[model samples]
Target chain A: MAGELALVADILSIISLIIGIFFLSLGMIGLLRLPDVYNRLHATTKVGTLGAFGVLLSIILQEGATPMGIKALTVALFILLTSPISGHMIARAAYRMGVKCCEGTCMDEYAGKRRK
Target chain B: MKRRLITYMALPVVWCLVSGYVTIGSLFLGLIFGMIVVEPFSKLYRLDEVVHPTGDWLAKIPKKIKYFYVLIKEIIKANIVVAKIVLSPTINIKPGIIAVPIRAKTNIGITGIANTITLTPGTLTVDISDDQSILYVHSIDATNPQGIRDSIRDDLEKYVLEAFE
Candidate 1:
């Protein structure tokens, strides 16, 4: 029974790791193919963070409920808090620098509301 | 006074978590050092004005934990949507920055909402008005701008109101 459980854990770990790697690669593809800085930021931040979290989950599955697993969970928590902030900051900076959105961008709500 | 005492006591607890040692000697040393660390910041900690008083803040922890759980669910949903958008062969997206009028009263409440919006689905809090009445958000998809604002007001802001206001 113990051996069977260990085998289950290993299978789950591999599946999760593959899922993570898949998302990370998709993020990279978006990064290269996207039109402008803002879209790139979206792709990298949102998809990339999820990908990283997937990898962390795989670590937990592999390690079970031990201290290292707990630490993996903590690291995931910190990533959730910080990744969006980084994305927000970068997008804001790009806007402030007067970077233009791509042609496909359907709306620009802050179009006329700039003081600077 | 009470605020000062609470921070002084709390710092050592935070220190223990960070240092990852629970020995009695380490805790006692943390207490002494925590006092020294927090003393200079005593005047700066307007805990009564800027935040809930210490006891009230402590009382809100369970509600905060519940909020964290809700936030995680939103994040996972968001990531899946983003993954689909990014991975699709066609370069599909509609991006805009809209002004999201906010209702949170205090600085802590406003910041809490802002951080929550930035972290969760399709939205990012870019700037706030001088009077703090509105938050300017750049969302990856705001084709239905009102939907974005309503979701933030209802889902995110309500719990923030519960915790901070």
Candidate 2:
């Protein structure tokens, strides 16, 4: 039973690692492909966090009783806390500098409302 | 002094349990090392609490769990799509950044939603409005921006509501 459980844990770890890497790669792709800075930021922040979490989760599962699991949990929590705040700061900085979206893009909800 | 002692002692206890080193001697050594090293560093680093979750929202736990289940399923599906794109030789990917209107109000909810978007494959959360009402997303393959926006509005919005609303 112990051996079986270890096997299951190993399989789960492998799966999680693959899933995490996959997300990270996609985020990188979005970063390169997106038309605008804001868009690229979106892809990177969202997908990067998830991918990192997945990889850490797999490590935790594999080392279920080790200090490694605690470390992984700490990293995950830190990423969760920081990534969004960074994204928010980036967007606010861009808007304050008057960065405009693509010409075809519709909806400028922030425009003309506060600008006198 | 007592709080400092407790905080200092926590890591060794965690280390002991994790390492399965239950002997009293080992525990004493680990506790001494942790207090000398880890406790000082922990106090040096500080995080400002910007948003706190109200315990009144505990009633939403069931709904949050259901939403989390759906999100996991979506994440798996997205991973498969991403893998396929990565392996293909054609590399027929069109990337675009699109602005998305966010409905989440509180800072915690907005941040949660943005993080969720970042966690998903093929989408990244780039920016959010100060009012927490808009999100800018970059997509790896954005041949259909409308479809992507709709997915965020519908699927992610549901989970965000459960988690933060």
Error of 1 at A32 (Å): 2.1
Number of the predicted model whose lDDT against the real structure is largest = 1
By summed lDDT, which 10 consecutive residues of candidate 2 chain B come out lowest? B44-53
List, for all models, the DockQ compared with the true complex: 0.49, 0.19
lDDT of 2 by residue, B28-59 (tens): 87788776776456546332223344676788
Here, model 1's chain A TM-score works out at 0.93
Winning model by TM-score: 1
Residue-wise C-alpha lDDT for candidate 1, range B7-27, written one tens digit per residue: 767877655544545567767
Residue A70 of model 1 has an lDDT of 63
Residues A67-115 of candidate 1 have per-residue lDDT tens digits of 5676677678778778877877887788888999887677776666655
Off by over 4 Å in 1: A1-8, A64-67, A111-116, B1-6, B13-55
Alpha-carbon shift of residue A30 in model 1 (angstroms): 2.4
